[model samples]
Target: MRFTPVVALAAFTASTTASVASDRYIVHFADAASARAATHASQFAPTERRLSDAPRHLRSLAAGGEVFELGPDEASRVSALPGVDAVEEDLMFEPTTVVASLWKRQWYMHDPKVGVDAEKAWKYTRGAGAVVAVLDTGITPHPEFDGQLLPGYDFISDAGAARDGDGRDADPTDMGNWSDPGECHSPEGKASTWHGTHMAGLIAARAGNRPGIVGLAPEAKLIPVRVLGRCGGRSSDIADAIVWASGGDVPGVPTLARRADVINLSMGTTGACGPLLRRAIEQARSRGSVIVTSAGNDQKNANTNTPANCPGVVSVAALGRDGAMASYSNFGNVTLAAPGGHIGDRGADDILSTWDIGKRGRERSVFGYRGGTSVAAPQVAALVALMRSADPDITVDQVTQQLVDNARPLPGPCPKGCGAGLMDAGATVDAVVEDRGRY
Candidate 1:
């Protein structure tokens, strides 16, 4: 009906919201239209779950909280929870992370501490034991990923769950936009940007070769999951995608997808997040996926964004090239910082990276410039991939500590924002290997 950014989500920041119905209560719609709306709006697709008619009494309602994938049994229990009826799948993947100002080049991959070091990557770990799922636009067939792109399901389709039935899609091409950025375009059809592709490049763009650019983890593989389509995916779609990415099966999707060790979501709604997204994130973590999300770029504070504010997830704030907190970055509870660029008197002061040319609106190939906390998220994801590769048993806690403890702290506004400091890739890698010595 009407297009809104659906930002500054209330569900995400709020401690809790009133439940709509019992997790297991039979949803009773007052009329068919109401049920149809719930069905259509649901991410479950063709075969959705809903109440036939409105219940005589209200048992509970949904609130904002990233839900993780639940085993069929867990689903039942969640249904058994006070305010949960049919659990409409929600995508826990938040794809918008980074300072949009950094759409060009921000982080110094060459810095010794954070520098791009293939030699060291070879010496320590090549990221073989890990699987990273990039829930954003899409990925083109590229040499960098080295056929590491696993099979993924798309949630953008009305049929519910897009499958590459042809078994195609293993490319590493960049999808870009010029004026617009991100697959999460404004529904008004304003612009486009291949933000997701660019972020992946920074994380795992083929390394060791003297090609266009270098990545943080050359040996890591990315699971391309397109949750945010044209104008971005709805909360319901995101929730479903999250369950699927973390190795869960919805009612219709018979096959349980392979779970990801690390899930990177760069997107976010500006307002307090709705229950739609929060439950999915919570469920994914329950399934054992470390969600590394971007703190919103609303130019306000970090404590505001959905998915980012969800607990257990490692929320990252932004920093500038000057090595200070990026003016546009939201700070509070910030697990770590990366180059998300800064807001300037003129506009955005970005420390960017090479993005998919498509987002830049390129006619030729897929490499362009883009920025935002969306970009910063991948750098951290790549580092985690490396950590897992070094040690397959690496826990989420260890990976987080490596990023924070090894980060190069910058001048901060205080504990209110920016929990740790700036992220250093080289330092993160060294810390894991030196400390564990196991993997």
Candidate 2:
């Protein structure tokens, strides 16, 4: 079944009533001393709530910092303070999914014009010794991942959202995200997306061994972390997933033996990146994890999409078969573009990846075609895996820089905001192997 575009997370709580502005504000100070000074200051003291979850390493942005109820005037005043590094209005967010038609072939990964050059790039490296974390709806036991899958955990904190009748367990199986009509407060029900399965297949489905489509990184290992579920997942849950996937601790969750070299976030919210998410992303980066996220499919500027809009992520845009930007893909913050596949080209033009068969509860192994920025982000993530394989010590910044510098120019409407242009897998691998950064 084709997946619907994901609704925005609850983080975007704005009203059309111009008279009533958001009063909640988040302030980031330059240091602990500054945060303490600001918290005690007459202006900040009266309104600060002192309720935050950020860790000590995060400094002023952590729990040590303070959240406040403030009007626009006061927010502006705080933004101008020398001690305040940044001040933003507290808001909610939602995840965006790209729309696509269903197809059953894997031609999108083979075609040169619109596809990533995975074949040639594979010659340089099959992404050995690299681990990719798929932070979405967990994975099913598909043969395409015989020896490529790694031990993973389910990070869905809410038992109802997990749908497995439990809260946060180690089992990362996809129990099906199918929902009854209005089950998730929706006007209509949704089919189990099996989104993580599709993404894992694209990144590292076994090559030349099985009857299924070959993944971009045949030798790379995949770590599935279930975040999205039932109706959708919470942004807070996703934040913790990011930290855990990058080999960081999450209080009670068990520590992972292997840390991810590349973290693929095919999902995100629509509002500004909250401090919780920003903290997770920064921590992941500090551990040398290259983060890749979808640019969204709202047909608007991607700079407005969280996680993608957040700094330190390689935000991806979707390209169609005609080598143009997909009509639904978000732009602006795109770090690079990839074949998200286009609709109306029949099934031949859409991205073909692993999927499941049967209705919800009775799912089986299968492959299908779909397109969206979600499809595009995994392509970038896989390439990063290859880059990491080529140079095991590569940093997050280096991998992103290599992709941007070696990208081929776009041939369509996107000139600037669509990133450096389409991703060239072969060239990107070559650059990494040659150690181009030193030059």
Candidate 3:
């Protein structure tokens, strides 16, 4: 009744050790003249004589200040000086990489041959006003997602699988999906994936946040639709979520105020496309929602994978830094290929995004690297958002055609067949904007 996610992820290691040297402080003066005069005062003689160099003066500031190293005992002495307004610690600031090196680690957004070239695409549009629905294990709170998430629903019907006690509610927060030994047909227990959070970050993590990697469509809005959880989620629940996300009515569920322009399905099961899912996809497409799906990680014919194999969906295949089909990626029937990274011993090539540090419950937030067609699918979905933002009236068929027509051939080989080609974000957005006569 349920299917597990097709993803491979690794935890990022970080350190919180503090520096043990004397703290630096900035002494603010009531006026610039007072600051200048204080530099020569007897009260400052001790600090001037103790330090190797002169204090850095900030006389141009509205409340002029001076930055200098200060011992705890010396700090108290300076705080009591005449005309000194305030003396505060000069805090050290570093790049966001100190917490998580997502920006530097995101090679898929820059590399010319194999990457999506998202930077070049930004010249055209940032996907403002577009909405994308992420249907997966649900989302977790992260700084990168601040102010970008829309009110979402939890569609997991089974009480045990939902893991929050009772079935289905308004909250779509990921409660952690760690499973026991032999759970969900696995040989051993597994940690919570925090999958939907990662997918959402890849689609639209806030830009200019400085601490995390920028998403493909930084201005787009995300709807976190909870479908998979615990051992996995049922197909029926996923089907219902698809309809609800695209503005279709479901029994006992409130109508969605804003329909998503793109629906991202990053989880799938083996076997033929079932009628239940087919109808949902058809209904979503009829409402102008372009559906995107992962081709699976089973490394076989993707035609045997549901949803990916389903009609009326844009199925994506996984590619590594080499632009070849990933060793773990399923192939045939794929619509496009995108960077999914190959997880080797070092995991240096994996796609890095926002994540959680918890194993089975809520914990501190962090960024991590993940691989699989699940990761690759969101890249296409985000691109679809950009396309929609450029031309709000673009049809679903037009969106799919532009993606296929502008895709570039993979720089590496895919003997088993990958897709139309590798996704070229720059070229694809250019083509769409041009088609709308925006040139």
Candidate of highest lDDT: 3
- lDDT, each prediction: 0.58, 0.78, 0.83
lDDT of 3 by residue, 1-439 (tens): 2211111000000121222245678877666666555544423343433332223233334444676565554556566655666788878787444222465688888787788988778898889999999999999999899889999999999989999897989999999899999888999999898999999999998745366777899889999999999988899999999999999999978889999999999988889999999999999999999999999999999998988999989999999878889999999878989999976553769898889999889798888889989999999999999999988988999999999999998889899988799999999989888889532
Question: What local lDDT does model 2 show for residue 387?
Answer: 92
lDDT of 2: 0.78
Clashing pairs in 3: none
Lowest lDDT block of 10, candidate 1: 4-13
Q: Candidate 1, residues 247-293: lDDT per residue as tens digits?
A: 87755553434578888889887666567677887788777778899
Clashes of 1: 116
- Runs in model 1 deviating more than 4 A are 1-107, 112-122, 159-189, 207-210, 254-257, 342-363, 411-416, 437-439
The candidate with the higher TM-score, 1 or 3, is: 3
Runs with alpha carbons beyond 4 Å of true place in candidate 2: 1-105, 343-346, 436-439
